[model samples]
Structures are given as C-alpha cells and as structure tokens.
Target chain A: METSVLKSKLQSYRELALKGINHYVPKSEPRKHLYDLVMDYPSRGGKGFRPGLCISTCKAWGGNEETAINSATALELFHNAFLVHDDIEDGSEFRRNKPTMHEYNNIGIAINVGDAMNVLSIKPLMMNINILGPELTWQIFSEIEHMVRQSVEGQAMELGWRKENSKCLTEDDYLRMILKKTCWYTTIHPIRIGAIIGSKGKVNPDMFNRFGFFMGTAFQIQDDVLNLIADEKAYGKEIGGDILEGKRTLMLIDLIQKLKGSNKSKLINYLANCRNENQLDNASWVLDKMHEHGCIEYARKVSKHMAGAALKEFYTCFQNVEDSEDKDMIEALIMHMISRDY
Target chain B: METSVLKSKLQSYRELALKGINHYVPKSEPRKHLYDLVMDYPSRGGKGFRPGLCISTCKAWGGNEETAINSATALELFHNAFLVHDDIEDGSEFRRNKPTMHEYNNIGIAINVGDAMNVLSIKPLMMNINILGPELTWQIFSEIEHMVRQSVEGQAMELGWRKENSKCLTEDDYLRMILKKTCWYTTIHPIRIGAIIGSKGKVNPDMFNRFGFFMGTAFQIQDDVLNLIADEKAYGKEIGGDILEGKRTLMLIDLIQKLKGSNKSKLINYLANCRNENQLDNASWVLDKMHEHGCIEYARKVSKHMAGAALKEFYTCFQNVEDSEDKDMIEALIMHMISRDY
Candidate 1:
C-alpha cells in the first residue's frame, strides 16, 4: 500500500478506536473526570501502532476492522494503563513531553484514576457481551489479564535486580525482561485478541498467540533502539529518557558488557546515582561507548533478526493460503513496523 | 453467643483466610518479592469482620461457612487495595498503628503488591466457581465493581470538601461521604457479599443489602467515635486521629457546627494546617473543645442507632426462619459487634 493510503487507513482506525473508548466511559460527571484523566495520557498523540497492528494483523488472517477495533480499544486502554502506572513507577513527569497524569494531577487522584481506568477497561467488554458474546468476552478478558500479569512480572524482575545492587546482569536476562514485560503484552495480546474475537472465537488461538509473541518481541526491541537513538522531537519522548530512569534495556546492558576501564566505572556510577542534569549526558556517553564496542550495530542486528524471525514464522504458517492478498498484508505490515522511519 | 465460642470462630476464619490468601499469591520467583511486600503489612491481624460478614451473612441466609470465608477473604484483599492507595494519598505512615505497606516497603513495590492483592481478591472466586458457579461469580464481581466506583466517588467528595476553605459542612454531608467512601465499600459490600454468596448466591439479597447498609453506617459511626474517645492501648489506634488528619467524620463535623469564638477559628486553622507536628497541641485542644460540645456523645448515639437499625433489618426478615441454630448464631454475632465491653 502507498504511504498516504496506509496513513489514512490508520487514521480511520484511530477515530474508530477513540469512538469505541468514548462510548464506554459514558457522559456522567464522575465518569467524565475519570475518562479525561485516563485518555489524557495516551491520546496526546500516537504512532497508533498498537491499535493499527491489531487491525492489520486481524485483516491478515481474514478478519474485519470493526471487531478488531473493540479489541483495539482495549489495546489502547491496556497500553495506557501501563503508561499511567509506569510513569508513576519510573517517576517520569512527562509523556509526549507533557507532564504525566500522576505528576500533573498529583499522585493520589492519579492512582485512583488509574484504578478506575483499569476496571473501566473491562466495562466495555462486559457491556458488549450482547455484541461480542460471553465466550469471546471471557477470552478477551483472559488475554488482557494474562498480559497484565506478564508485564507486572517483568517489571518486578527488573525492580528486584535494580534494588539488589547486582551487576551480574546478562544480555539473556535483559532480553527475557523486555520480552516478558513489554513484548507480548503490547503486541501479541492485542493481535491475538483481535484475531480470536474477530473470528468470533473460531480461531485456534495458538497461531495468533505464536504470531503475537514473535511480532511483539520485534516491536519491543525497536522501541528500545528508538529510545536511545530516535529523533526526540518526532518521538515526543526524550531520546535518552530510559537511561535517565536507569531502565534495564538491551542497549544499556549490552553497552555495559562491551565497555572497559574508567568508561565502564563512569557508566555504572552514573546509573547508580542518576539525577536529571546528568542523565542525558550519561545516556549519550553510554550510547557512544556502545557504538565504539559495536554493540549498537549488534543491538540493531538483534532487532532485525527478531522481526525477520516473526515474518518467517508468519510465512511458514499461513503464506500458502492460495490467496495473495492476505499474505501480502501480513508481509507489508511486518516490513513497515520493522523498517519505518520515525 | 458466648465470648469464647465467638473468639474461636473469628480465630479459625482468620487462620483459614490467611492460608487461602497465601495460596492465591502463587509462588513465582520474579513476583515473590512483591508478594512479600503485601504479606508483611500487618499480616494475620485484621478483625476479619468484612470477611466474616461475607461468610456469616451467607450462613444466616442458609449457606455454608466455607464460601463465606472465601468471600470474606476476597473482601479483605480488596479493602487492602483501597488502604494501600489511601495510605499514600493520606500520607499515612502507619496502619493498625504500625508502619503501613508503602512506608514499610517503598511506594513503588507496595503499589504493585496492593494491585496484586486486589487482583488476587478475584482469583479466589474463580477457584470457587465450581462451588458458586459463573452466575454467582458475575454477581460478586459486579458488587465489588460497584463498591470500587462508590469508593472513588467518596474519595472525590472528601477531597472536594477538604479543598474548600468554607467551614459549612453538615452532618448529612459527612454521613453521605462516609456512606459511600468508608461504610458501603468497607462494611456493607462485604456483609452483603458474604450473605448472598453464602446461600450459594440464592439468598434474599434484598434483605442482606439493607442489613449491610445499616451495619456499614453503624460501623463508620463507631469508628468515628472510637477515633475520638476509645482507649489508646486497647483500640490499637491513636485517639483523636481523625481530628488530627482533618478528616470529616461525624464527631468532628458536629463539633465544628456547635462551636464559636476562638475555638472555632482554632479548629478551622488547625484543620487547614493540622498536617504538621507543631499543630498537634492545638489539634488536641480542638478535640477537647469537641468533647465539651458533647460531639462525642452525639456520635456514639448515632452509631448505636445505626447498629440497632441494622439488627432490626436482619431480624424483620429472618425472625420466622425455621433454623434455630442460625437464628441464635446471627443474634450472637450482631451483639459482639455492637458491644464495647472493653
């Protein structure tokens, strides 16, 4: 598809996804307060990648857009739920370079607002039982629940390591944390949910699940790379934001292993007592060190490999369906996500 | 009805609720540290009335005690969820007059622990679906959802009043706040849940709802009174704690209404800035003035009336029931709650 056509389709889906969300919050005084609090954080802007992937991946498997949007709305809600709590956890005051919900609203009301959003995330599915049916509702709810647990588990693992002052961290550990925490929860659950519910629960679920896992991993690695090296103005989140927060991303871990002497000690100390003024400088130094050691190239290679592996998996399972359209859509989306210029 | 027998039941239920709660946490290495953060917060010492009401009310409606215990455990977990966030909001350093979960553990990990407990609250019901089934699970989940909404509403109302510099709060306004924020969510929901879920969810839900409402109001009033005049050592929480926090309990509202002159100004100013240690003496002096205004007696009367009304509601529906054993047990439990022998 042409860029303009693809962009327009994505725009339409964004409107549909927002509409799906607006209907659930209802126009009550109290409900509106909650709606504003939640949507404020996530809707400032989006590449709309999560919801788009949800729609396209479903279309890849011969699913329609409408069914995909409900799951997509949930994708957006779950994504923002992570945003709300993660912002609070990381103490990042900014999202889209604007003050985060908790920091702007103050933590108490923000906490309640987040709690309400989480519960409200399920409300749409509950109310849509007539449209979605109880069985599909249960499946979607279960998928969302499983994703939350995995993300939280991944976070806990990272926090545990961060607290214990342990530097025995490895690339394997970093990958596992990112995969469990970010990968599938963001990608697979949304895709699998779209596929499963769009199929009206007729899909075997396992194929979508496998497809989501590989794609989601690819999606997460790209995100880590972008945080280190993307144009901050376009991304709207700071390029070195993760380093400022001492996040245990692949780039940081890889750089640590490859750097030597005072460079390594400086990076370690900067991470340990990280303050705002020094964070970006430290992040830049670490990035340069990683490049010097070829770790940046190595990280890029890993990201491509993950995306390629997922594309290979998609082809191995469904490429020979005798319909070129479905295969073309899958391959196009995979290519676009993996190679898109942000 | 004897003290020893009541003690045994409370003790037994507490033991079982703990065991069941431990089982729900699920031993995953990554998440165990987070679980430990929740487990260590004043563990093994809730009075268990919330859970007890769940099971007890269920039993009163002709259901088994085990399901009551399960429902009770669920309520306990959910309440802890509210407390964790509330503590952070209120800057509460202590719970049960000891270090609160967040203060004992850092806020980040404690936030996750509380969320896990909240999530775990519903998991036990899923496990109990074999005994209670899907319909009942839906009912319990719905009831829990409603309580969460009301609690948010209540919190909003209190924060609204606190932000208002005007000193024109009525007893009615205070009562409404407590009803939604503290009473219904804390006491009534658990009571009704225990009762309804007890009859295996086939009980006279209407009767239990009213019973829980009255009892919940009574419980809040008693808590208000206890906050003012209860024995510091025996009560296990500091006296005049509500007044110090500038919380709009019935006792403080009554005193604020009836007072005039320097005392009124003192109370108002103390409330506006009572958050500091330097304000403690003035805050205590204001509490003393509240005692002089008979605010304490007024609060105590309101509490007794609510409890009496709750008992009347329980009695009116079940007076003609055929089971003498259940009738006696119900009578015994209600007495123990209202009585202040210590």
Candidate 2:
C-alpha cells in the first residue's frame, strides 16, 4: 500500500515539474528552444526523491502544498542546473545513457541554457513575494549562494585530490567532501527549506537537517556500491563510471589496502586509465577481486549503518506525531530505503 | 561658477578610480600579475565617466558618498566584466590597442577571471542590507540580469547580421543595440538603483529616472563620436576600431547614406576585408571619403545635439536643488562633459 502511494505522488510531482518549467518561457519566442533543451532526454524519468521529500517535509511542518510548490520548483530547476554544468565540467558525454546537453547541443548554448535555468529557478521565489519578507528572501538567497559556492569549491578540491591519485584520504575527508558536494545541496537544503515554509518556522527544523545529512550520505554510499554490481541495463549509466573518472570510492580505498605489489600496481593502472577499452577487462577483474576480498560488501554494511542513524531519528519524530497513519507511512518509507535492492 | 565646480567633482572621481580595485585584491598575489591585469593600458587611468556620473547622481538624490562609492565600484567591475567577455566574442587581439586578456593570459584562465569578477561584483551589494530592503535588492539583481541577457542577445543579433551580410538595419536598430549593450547597464540602471535606495519608497522618483535616461542617452552618443576622432595615444584605445569591425555607428550610418555609387563598394570592401596593412589603408581611404562627404562632422553635430538634450534635463534639476553650491557643482560637471574632446 505504501509503495503504491509513493509511486502516484512521484508521478504527480513529475508532471508539475514539466508545467513549472514550461510556464517560464515567453510565448513570443519563435520556437520553444529552452524547454526543448530540457525535455530532450525522455528516458531519464527521475525518482523525484529530493522534490518528493521536500513535499513530504512541507506537509510535515503544516505548510500549504501550493505555497511549497514554488520552493519545490526551485529545487527541481537547481538540481537540473547543476547537472547541466557538471556534465560539462566532468567532460561526461552521456547522462542517463543519452548524450549530455553539451554533447547534444554545442557547449556554448549548453552553458547559456544552464545559466538560464539557474536564473529561472529563482524567479519563482522572487515572484512569490506576497508570502515572503525582506529577511526571509535574503535568507533563502544567502543559503543558495553558499551552497553553490561551496559545491564549486568542493569540486575543485576533489579534482585536485584526484590529480594526485589520492586513494589514501581518511574517512573524515571523504565525508566532508561528499557532504559539501552531494548531500548538502541534494537533500538537507531542499528538506529544511520545505520544512521552514511548511511550519513557517514552527517546528524544531534542526532535526530535519541532521537526519537528512545521514540519509543522503547513506544514499550516496548505495550509489557508490551500485557502480560495481548494478546491472548496466537497469542503471542507465556507465558501469564503474566513478572508477573511470578516478573518484576515490570506499571500495577502491579498501581494495588498495588489501592488495600489494603487481596486483596493486595493475589495479591502480586500471583505475587511472579508463580510456583503454582493452584494460576494461582488468578493471572488471579488479572489481571481482574487491568483492572476493569482502571490500564491496563491507562498504554496503557501512551504508546500512548510516541509514540506521537516520531511521532512529525518523522513529523519534514519528512517536510524537498526532496522526498515527502518517507516522506509519513515514516509517515504512524509511524501512524501504534501508531494505530495497535498488 | 557652477560649471567650473562640476569639472573638479568629475575629476575627483577619476583620480581614485584604480585605488579601490587595488585595495580589493590581496597583496599576497604576485603584485606584477595583479598590476598587469588591472594596469593594462586599455583598462587603466580612465576618466571613469560612467561611474562618475553614477556617483554624482547618487549624491544628487540626497544619498551619502559612502553608499555611492561601493555602487560606483560595482559599476567599474561590471564594465570590466563586459570587456572580458566582449573581447573573446569579437576576437580582436587588442583592447585599448594592447593585448586582450586571453592574449595576455590564456582563454581558460581569462574566462575564470571574468567569472570570478562577476561573482565578486555582488559582494559589495551584500554589505548594503541596512540601507535597503529585500525588494530593492531583488529589483537591482533583476535589472542587472536583464541588462546582461539583452547584451548577449544584441551580441548574438550582431553576429547574425554580420555573418549574413544583412544591410537592412537602420539608425533606430543601432540605437536599440547600444541601448541594451551600453546605455541600460552603464547609466540607466545605476541611476534608478541609486534613487530607489535613497527614496526607499519615501517619494516618487520619476523625475530622477527621466533625468538619468536623458543623460545616459547623451553620454552614449558622445562615446560614439569619440570612437572616430579621439587620439589613440590619449584614449588608450583604437580610433576607428568599430569601423574596422563593421560596427554600425551613427557616423557609419550617415556615411552609408552620403557615399553613393563607387564609395559604397569601397567602404564595404574595407570593412569586410579587415586585415593586413593594405586593408587598413583601404579603411583609412574610406575614412577620408567620409570626411569628404562631411559625415564625420555631421556625426559630431548629432552627438552635440544629444548632449544638449541631456543638458536641458540636467539644468532643470540643477535649478531645483535647495543649495546653490550643489547646483553650481552639477552644472559645472555637465559643461565639462560637453566640452571635453576625449
């Protein structure tokens, strides 16, 4: 019952996302070039997780769905905005198994489109001034600006680290980088913003932030593990893509520690050299060795452990909810995240 | 007495133009590299007519000098931001007849610098929270973003026109281009923002806006004239540079009308085939023909006419000032602009 409910809500949000983006462009434009740029990839149906969570959070805080929709649209726009630029910066030709924006169109126009989306993202909030005060408007903008600035800084720092073939970074450093680059923008920001608008600052919003950080981290680790064992056809992205880009995943770190001599050197060579399709066999061979060494499963256990921390908070919040049915639904959703293979 | 007083006030703005740019950059950066970028012949030691007018307009609106200074700094940075990108778009090797940013550094780093400067332009405004409200802050951002979008559109339009060799554009069309690319960002927006910040809904600011618009249009016309006759040595920029690039200035428009038959073909060849010493000679020959056709002097007269219209508005405002000394100073400044050759 919970699974069916989540699916319908996800579909509704997806349609709203399309409507939100389409409404921004002027009818006078000779052709709908910008909208066409966004909807070009049809296969990439989103899970709508960040936005769905945002909606749920807004409801959790007792904010009106209509009021929160503007914030949700902003989140969706920002999410795609980063995807556009990130694809270019990383020089990834494909996203969701289709050519990236810069690849499909030229780089110059892609850059323009990314910028336009970023601009359009804020237009929603700016237009909704009847509900916003001067302090709150500045508050939201300052938060977004810091998020974007830190994300860019994190990307630069990670690229610097990657250049050194840095597989030896401590877990603390890894957590800091991912939290800055992935979790903060992806989860906590959207959830907390939704909660704030819902409660209009009523609830203890700090707990939402704390739980979101761990859940997002757990989700990221799941993604990192999926890069190895996940079916290529189902994943809709290149297999071992992170290792191809020389990203220092937890599995890679563990594998490095377990191997030595020529085995280690060969693994490093495969990790560093993603271009040689002939060496892809060796890369896969290394992946198998990591599984055999218990490195991959060990990383998955860690992810589950982090997800457990998030579930603890969810149950605490659920116990205090006046509506038992909503509390039950929230717990079921949390359990699914921890248990689901996907 | 008023006319003389305005001259010194205008000069005062110029004398310290570089000081703020210097102060903002940390001393830890190689002094030579920093100096080389800012102190380049094209960028340095200018009249800063745009920023000067902005500062003066702010003062006239009863705003303090401190509030105006940061706004003026933002204006200068904004100007350089355009220059950074425009040089790349136009692809000429020089700016102010010296090497362009990309030529001095490289395209990648030059682009990064331009991006950094754009981001930095807003930091000063963040310091203005106490004086202005969120409504005003958002308005200013919208204005800047609007200007930038139009400028890029104008650039794309110009590129299309040049590529297709479209000669259908008129004097009105040229005005629209400059209005977007120059007048809006440089003058109109600054004036409106200053008024908005000062008045803060205190009073109707329509008169100040009209005053600024008229002055901005006049300032733009004067610049077009200077592009033709100013000494390259004194201006630190190329004379007839726009002509070489086939920019449809007012003089170029009149020249097209005046030079019938063979001179028209000669002008087109000189402009379209803009390369090498001999081609430059062809351009010079066309300029000589424009002089023979009296187009040069005709453009100068038109500029003076525009300047006169601006002066009329400026003078009316001057007469209304409560203090006679302020009246004198502003009138003096307007006269200085009218009389100056460069």
**Candidate topping lDDT:** 1
Off by over 4 Å in 2: A1-4, A28-45, A96-98, A132-138, A159-170, A221-302, A316-319, A323-342, B1-53, B69-127, B133-174, B200-319, B322-342
- TM-scores of the models, in the order given: 0.90, 0.72
Interface root-mean-square deviation (Å) of every model: 2.0, 5.0
> Which CAPRI category fits model 1?
acceptable
**Model 1 segments beyond 4 Å from truth?**
A29-35, A58-69, A275-295, A320-330, A340-342, B68-70, B163-167, B228-241, B276-278, B323-335, B338-342
CA RMSD of each candidate after superposition:
3.1, 6.6
User: What is the DockQ of the complex in model 1?
Assistant: 0.46
- TM-score top scorer: 1
User: Candidate 2 lDDT, tens digit per residue, B1-342?
Assistant: 654455567667644444555555434422233323533432454566656666666666676666666656666766775676566545556666577776776443343344334444555555555556555556666766665555544554454455445555676876666665566676666666655555453434456555555555566666766767787676555777766767677677777767768878877666566633346677677678778888778766765675676678776754554564434554555555546666
Candidate No. with top DockQ:
1
- Calculate candidate 1's fnat: 0.28
- Tens digit of lDDT per residue, candidate 1, span B273-325? 87666677887797788778888888878878878887898788676555655
Restricting to chain A, the TM-score for each candidate equals 0.90, 0.88
lDDT of each residue in A23-43, candidate 2, tens digit only: 654343213334456545422
